[model samples]
Target chain A: MKNILIYLRLGLRNLLLYPMRTGLTVIGLGIGIAALTFLSAMNDGWLQNMKLNFVLTQMGHVQIHAQGFEQSRRISDYMGDTTLVDEALQSMQSMQGGIQAWSHRIRVSGLASAAGANASVLVSGIEPEREKDVSRLHTFMQQGTWLQPGDKRGVVLGDVLADRLSVGLGDKVVLMAASPDGDIASEVFRVRGLIHSGVMDVDNLLALIPLKMAQHWLHLGAGVTDVVIRTNSFAVVDSVVSNLQQRLSGKPLEILRWQEIDPMAEQWTMFAEIYTWVVLLVVIIVVLAEVLNTMLMSMHDRVREFGLMAALGTTQQQLFAMVVYETLVLVFIGGILGFLLGGAVSLYYGEYGLDLSQYATAFSFMYMSSVVYPELTFNGCARILVAAMLGAVLAGLYPAWKASRLNPAQAMREI
Target chain B: MSDHVLLEAGGLCKYYHSGGSDVAALDQVDFQLEKGAFTVLSGRSGSGKTTLLNMVGLLDTPDMGSLHIAGENVLALSLSERANFRLQRIGFVFQAYNLIRVLSARENIAYVLQLRGMKKTERLAIADHWLFEVGLDGLGNRRPDQLSGGQQQRVAVARALASKPALVLADEPTANLDSVHGESLMSLMRDLNDRCGMTFLIASHDPVAMAAAQQCVYMQDGRIVSVATP
Candidate 1:
């Protein structure tokens, strides 16, 4: 321990011999780490946003539907009012620790006409009070008010649909679809709200109406298209699904998690993670090369110094250890500073957010938000720190070998 | 293997490849230094005085020779073993490149003891004692760059003798000092040799070094021509 402390002191003193070079080398490494951490933090925040806006807001935590509803995908193939399923959901709220908010929704795709313009869209029948707890749709009102329980003829149009139809708040629109009896059914509703959900597909193709009104027009009679349940957090979604499956076993319902229903969201997250690893690997390699270059150059300038140590009986291994110790100190200081600086930048972004809302058209189309928050996690910081330290140790290899192999007698000759 | 002999180099030969010809730097050179002797290897430049010192110091290997320090054949030791033995037994004082510039005078002296696994408190105490012995009692904290040339040389001398080695090898010990400083350093070394019975084998062309030596050997063309007791 004493020897190591002495050696470390010596190594630090040696580095102090060339302050400018040392600082430059450390800054080079710090830049690499900073870039790595900053990009990683941004990716983490993007994934979280995707989960919030694209996945949970749209798919909920879990969805239950009739067994054959998936195969047909028909609005008329709605679930019947099963006392058994209703009782199971009621029991779940009490028994399951993960259950947060849940709501029943009846969604159907059909053609709607407003004024002289018409377009195809998916219209949802919802309970206003319950939906506010289940999804973010209620908060996205761009114009006018959302549907009320007492407003039977009220309708909320996605901003994209309203734009295509050239309709505004209070404009009336007619909804048309085929009923279960194979007959064409139609209803006229006044536009109560125009919502911009920050999702291109949803904005272009979604609308909402009161559930009681939808049941009255479609003759569903206490039937719902699907039951959506939200868990407390995404971390417990699988467990919630599993527990629900056990309770609802042998029933005529198919339960699916958000990830299972929207595989694209899961795939996107995986791709982002892989991309992060590739970026981190490239940054580490670059850092290693830069550190190696600096150490080799420093070794060249200290030929006589190394020879003196060797003459004083420093062994090959001890010389190699000194080189490694020197590189470690450089990397340790640089990496820590990089982590802190990157964390600070990300924290600032997290608090104030990075606004890209100006690109609303392009970003909204793909279910992305213009405002992004960069996130930094303990796991990410730890992984980057480990990688940087390993890079430093590996960078010391050739230089340490060169120093260890020096002949003290010949090295002093050049002095 | 005599008890009085502190260092022995028998038939030591070292060759250098220069000018497309093999030059014998130390050709069948046989030398011995007894215990408590202040000896000098005096020769003109390129007469192989430094090479002989290096060979005896174990800084380089001989093509064919045997070297024994304190009756142990150190040349037969492994490369790493030779390094460990050098730290454990031998000390070196170089003329120009002597001290490690990064360390203070005390650290340079205690560096060997640290390598030998000495405790920090004991190592510092011993280093301080050696610093006082070299007439730089309170200047132990000064780095090589901070000390004058004469003081630095004294520190180098102190460092070489700090480990209490069986023999001290000095190559051109006074080549970098002025006449007055060189004479004073030589007198200090001679006093140590006389009073403390430290064995010193120094290679130098300095007349003062030759005058202070109890036994001086002259070399010409990689071979010893004569030995003098002046």
Candidate 2:
């Protein structure tokens, strides 16, 4: 250990002998690591925005439905008794802090006609007072007001659906759908609000109505098709789902997390994670190339010095260790510089957010917000640092080997 | 191999390829140095004085030779073992005053002791004593580039003797200095040799170095032609 410290000291002194070369090499490596850190923050921010938009605007963290309701979507597949589900939810809510909110709804396909124009739509029967607590759908309202409990004939239509029906707030539209009793039921409802969610499917084919009115019109008698649940955080969704499944066991019900409802969002998250790693790999290679080039150049410049050390009783292993120690010092400083540089920039942007309004259309297509807040997580920063050091070691190996293998006499003879 | 003989080499031969043909650098050289003796090997350039020193220093391997230093068959050691042997038993001073430019005068001298696993304070104390012995007492903190050529050479001498090796090999130790510094350096080496009872074999054609030696060996075309008491 003492000898190793001496070698380290020697290596440090040798590096200090060439300040300009050492400083430039450190800065070059710093810039590469900074790029990696910044890219990772951006990717993290993008994925967060995508998940938030998908979960908040429509799918809650978890959902429960009749066994075959998701695949069939038939009104007859509704859960006739929500007694066990309500009991499970009440117990969970009493436990304090996992389930944030929940709401029951009846969802069915329908056709809307107004001003002699018709369009296909999926209508949701919701309790307005409970719906707001479970989803952020009301927050996306573009016009008029959300449905109220006493407003029996009031309905809300997505902007695209309203445009197709040639109707606006206060206009009456006829909604027609087949009841589970084998009857074609129809009703006239006044449009209460217009929702402008960026999701094309949601904007083109959704209508919201009062739960009591839909229950009466469809002759379902107080039954709900599905229950949507919101957890305090996405991380707790799986555990919450498991708890609910256990409580509602043997009751012909299926429990699912948000990812199962919108598979594309889950796949996009996976792709984003994989993309970050690929970018990290590429950046590490760049760092490796830069460090390798600098170390090789430094070694060539100090060939005679290395020869002198070898002649002064330094073993081949010691010489190799000296070179590695030099690289460790260099890369360690660079890694800190990069972490600070990247962290400062990310923190600044995280507070104010990076405005990507010019690419709003592209972002909207992916269900992402126009302004993204760059987040630098601890894990992300640690990953970048570990990878940079690993790259530095790999970069140092060849030059260290070459230096240790030098023939002392021949090297000392170099002018 | 008498007990007083510190180094012995027989039938030492070294060859180099020049113009696609082998040229003899050291041809059938036979040499011996007694403990505590100061010797000089003198020759013109390319007469293989430095080549012989390199062989003795273990910096180069002779094509054919049997060498023993302090009764150990040095030629039979492995690469790593040879390195350890050099560390513990041999010291070298080069013509270029090859002091590590980054280290202080004291550090250069203490580096060998450090490699031998000596504690910092102990090695540094020995370094200071050697510096004082070589007339560089207060200049221990100065780097080689910060010191004059003569001062740097003094520091190199201090470094070589600080290890108290079994044999000290110097190749052209005074070639880079003028007559004044050269004479002073030779006087210092002779004084150190007499005071410490250390064996030294210096390769130099300098008249001052030749004059200061207790015995001189003259070489021609890689062969020792004469051995004389100066």
Candidate 3:
């Protein structure tokens, strides 16, 4: 241990002999690590935004539907009795950190016509007060107000759908759908609001109406197509789904978490995670190249010095260790500098958010917000630093080996 | 090998290839050094005095030789074993005053002791004593580049002796210095030889070094031609 410390001290002194070279190499590695850290934070922010937008705008953390209702979407497949679902939800509400909010929804495909123009739509029958607690759909109102309870003849249309129908707030539109009794039922509803959700499907095809009115029109007495539940966090969604499954066992209902509801979202998240690592790997390779270049140059410059050390009784292993220690010192300094620079920048951006408003249209299409808040966790910082050090060790090895292989007598004769 | 004989070499032969032909650098040389003796190998350039020093210092191996230092057959040791042997029993002073430029005068001397597993305080104290003994009492903190050429050589000599090795090999120790520094350095080596009984085999053709030697061996064409008491 004492001998190792002496070698380390010698290594440090040797590095100090070439300040310019050492400083530039350190800065090069620092920049690479900083880029890795910053990009990782940005990727984290983007993925978080995508996930939040997915759950808040439409899909809640967990959902329950009648067996086969999701695939069939037929009015006849609606849950005829709400007793089991209500009992399960009431039991869940009493559990610690359980469901935050839940709402029953009746969704059906229909056609709307106004001013002699018609467009296809997915009409959602919702209880306005309960839905506001479960989803952010009410916050997307662009004109007029969201649906209110007891507004039996009122309806809300997506902005694009209203445009297709040539209707606006206060205009009457006729909704037509096949009832569970095999009759084509139709009704006239005044447009109460227009929603601009930035999602193509939502903006082009959604129609919201009071649940009581939809139940009467569709002849589904006390029946709902699906129930959406919002939990405090996504982390609890799977456990909540499992609990609901157990509570509603053998009741002809399918309980699913959000990922099961939209597998594409989960896949996208996984791809983002993998992409971040690939980018970090590329950065590490770049850092490894820089470290290799610097150490080789140092070795070339100090050939005679290495020869002298060898002649002075330094072992081959000690020579190799000396070079490694020098490289490690440089890497340690660079890693800390990079962490500070990247962490500070990420913290600043995280607090204020990075404004990507120019790409708002593209971001909205991908179900993300324009303003993204970067997050730098302890684990993220640690992973990047460890990668940099590992790269340094790998880079240092070849040069250290070369130095250790020096022929002392021949090397001493070098001019 | 005898108890008084610190180094012995028989039939030492070294060859170098140049232009596809081998030239003998050390051809069938026989040598011995007694304990506490100050000896000099005097020769012209390319007469293989430096080559002999390199062999004795364990920096290079002879093509054919039975070499023993302090009763150990050094030529038979592995690369690692040779290094350990050198560290424990041999020391060297080069003509170029090849002190580690990054280390202080004291550090250069203490480095060997540190390699021997001595504690910092103990090694540094020994370094200071060697510095004083080498006439560098107040210059222990100066780096080689900060010191004069002669002072740097003094530091190198101190470094070689600080480990108290059984044999010290010097290659043209006076080649890079002027007469004044050369005489002073030779005088210091002789004084240390008498005072501490440290065995030294210095390779040099310098007159001052030859004058200070207790015994001198003359080499020509890689063979020792004569041995005389100076």
lDDT of 2 by residue, A98-180 (tens): 98889999999989999999999898999898899988889889999999889999999999999999999999999999898
Evaluate fnat for each of the predicted models and list the values in order. 0.84, 0.65, 0.69
Report lDDT per candidate.
Answer: 0.85, 0.88, 0.88
Query: How do the residues A336-391 of candidate 3 rate in per-residue lDDT, one tens digit apiece?
Result: 87888888899999999999988877766667788889889887787787778778
Docking class of 1: medium
Instruction: Candidate 3: list runs displaced more than 4 Å.
Output: A67-78, A108-120, A174-188, A215-220, A245-253
Spell out the clash pairs found in candidate 3: none
- Candidate with the larger DockQ of 1 and 2: 1
TM-scores for every candidate against the unseen true structure: 0.90, 0.93, 0.92
lDDT of 1 by residue, A222-293 (tens): 888888887888898888788778988987888888766666777877978897787668667966987899
The candidate that wins on TM-score is: 2
True lDDT of residue B200, candidate 2: 94
Question: What TM-score would candidate 2 get against the native?
Answer: 0.93
What are the runs in model 1 whose C-alpha is more than 4 Å off? Answer: A27-36, A65-89, A108-110, A113-118, A150-153, A170-190, A212-225, A250-254, A282-286
Q: On residues B145-210, what C-alpha lDDT tens digit does candidate 3 reach at each position?
A: 999889999998899889988888888888899999999999998898888888999999999999
